[model samples]
Target: MAQQRDTAEADRTLKAKHRAIWASGDYPSVAAEIIPGLGALLVEACGVKAGDRVLDVAAGTGNAAIPAALAGADVVACDLTPELLEAGRLMADRSGVDLRWREADAEALPFADADFDTVLSCVGVMFAPHHQAAADELVRVCRPGGTIGLLSWTPEGFLGQLLTALKPYAPPPPPGARPAPLWGDPDHVRALLGDRVTDVSAERRTVLVDRFETPEGFRDYFKERYGPVLAVYRAHAEDPERLAALDRDLAELARRHDRAAGSGPTVMEWEYLLLTAHRTDTSP
Candidate 1:
């Protein structure tokens, strides 16, 4: 019992850390400027339609939720950080779409079992510290015949490599926490959803981002705006030498992946995995 209590406390601490990390930088800006279209992509892939009761888990600023709601679905967008949800709520209001914003943990959602006809995440949920727990919650809240959709950064993608680059400076992941990039792996996700979902389909896709004109620009933008990257910089704030090295490595990673004409703006295609499946039908 003592050991279990310790574990539970550790879990709470880690969850708190995650909430802080996401709330640290200006992520809503990143979502709006860099990866906005991916939300629409996930919504289309999930086949979300009118009147569907949809839940968007780890939905930062309602990226997918807003689109789903605009499609006429009844949407509830949940995230660990209330700050982000509030930002999303405001955006939904501006878009003239009715959306419910809830602060929720992907690993332990508050809704009743099988409450949603459609459940999805766009570049969300993958950040859950506990992989299996999150996957279980995803399957549990979705009706047996309901759809489950996910869009995540692939391990081979630019964002995945960026995460790897930042790991040297970032805090060690909590015990038993899996890397977020694995959600982009088809085989890995298949195993996670095993026997609980059916008719699974996975697609490898890319989104072209031209937000920055140079490698240094990309690195600098992330330094200022991206939460995970900024958190690492904060971790090494007193260590100027290490921070310089991290900056160098990040800029180099961007340069290596950049594809652009010598004269025009920098262009990079960030790879992602789009996976959709239906909850296993268990009706008698």
Candidate 2:
């Protein structure tokens, strides 16, 4: 009972945060920084073809789902937050692509055996409290001879430094935070797949980071477009003192990260791994 209650509370809190952050238009641009590279790579790795059924896990705002659908694959996009799904639906419509948007949990997928020809997730599985369970769920829905493709961020270089700079204002994240969505250590993915797959491999790619156009852009984007950070501000209900402090802290951080507007685009180096594995039945 206690565990269920805690989970419920956390879900509510995270949902509220996610909704608020995505409500603003600033987030999509911020997300565009990293989404395209990951999305493209996953699509290529999945080898989606016309008429093939594809499952996009944690499909935030249809970044990957939109492109895959454009390629003529039948696509199902699933995510935990309704707000994010709404955004994705809007994007899909704008792109003139038909994508089935479903609200579902990654750890417990609502699909049947061999339901999809390919399973793809862009920074999705890592959110599962039980990585193995979620991974198993991913493998479960894929056809016996299908492909499983996952995209995860590797925390290193400019990416690590940038995230470190922004960490103070965000929610008190769990300790030792690696990258999110696909947050687990690399070994965990290999262990989970076991003998279920073959031709398994992982690689890195650079994502173009474009959230802040200027120092002021950074301040506004973080304050208005970041969910967990705004959650912290929401927590200060009726407390003017804390609000001022948070504002001051964010201001300082913005100044530190801010560079001249025409100083050329600042790119955050994100090492993302595209893991590809084929079901055992399909392999020679």
Candidate 3:
């Protein structure tokens, strides 16, 4: 019983840390400015039709949920951080879309079993500390025949390279937390979903990102606005040299991945995995 209590406490602590990390940065800006189209893409991929019941797990600022609601689906956006949910709620209201925003953990969802017709995440649930727990919750909450859609950054993509470049400077991952990019691997996702889902379809898609004309510009943007990146930079606030090294590393990565012609605009394709499967049963 004491061991169980300790574990639970630790889990709470970890979750709190995650919430703080996300709330500390201006993630709403990043979501709105950089990857706004990803949400619409995932919503279309999930076949989120009108009147369908949908749940967006780990939804950050309603990136996917808002679009799903805009499609006329009855959507609920849940996330670990309330700040993001509140922002999303306001955004949805402004858009004249109705959707519920709830603060819930992806690994341990607060919804009932088989409650949703379509369960999806877009570059969201991949950040869950416990990947299997999140996957199981996704399967558990989705009704049989409901679609399970995920859009995540591929391990070989620009986002993946960006993460790799940051790894050397970032703090070690917390215990039990897996690398977020692994969700982009088809085999990894398949293994997690296992026999609970059928008619699995996986596609590799790329989104064009031309947010900055220079690699350094991109790096600087992330440093100030993105959550994870800001957290790492915050950690090195007292150490200018370490921060400078990370800046160089990230800029170099962006330069290497940039495919722009004549330096007119920085064109980089961020590869992501789009996996859609039909839930079969609740059997584990």
Top candidate (lDDT): 1
Task: Give candidate 3's TM-score.
Answer: 0.97
Candidate 3 versus truth, CA RMSD in Å, comes to: 1.2
Please provide TM-scores, in order, for all candidate models, with all chains considered together: 0.98, 0.75, 0.97
Off by over 4 Å in 1: 261-263
Please tell me which predicted candidate would have the highest TM-score against the true structure: 1
lDDT of 3 by residue, 1-284 (tens): 99999989999998998999899878998889989989999999899999999999999899999999989999999999999988888888889998898999999999999999999999999988899999999999999999999999999999888877778887788778899999999999999999999999999999989979788888999988888888889989999999989888988888888897437667789999999999996564
Candidate with more favorable, higher TM-score: 1 or 2:
1
Error of 2 at 166 (Å): 6.4
The digit string of per-residue lDDT tens for model 2 on 45-84 reads: 7898888899998777767788899899999999877777
Clash counts for the predictions, in order: 0, 0, 0
Considering summed lDDT, which 10 consecutive residues are worst modelled in model 2?
175-184
| RMSD of each predicted structure | 1.4, 4.5, 1.2
Cα deviation of 79, candidate 2, in Å: 1.0
TM-score (C-alpha) between model 2 and the true structure: 0.75
Clash pairs, candidate 2, are none
In model 1, the Cα lDDT at residue 97 comes to: 90
Task: Please identify model 3 stretches exceeding 4 Å from their true place.
Answer: none
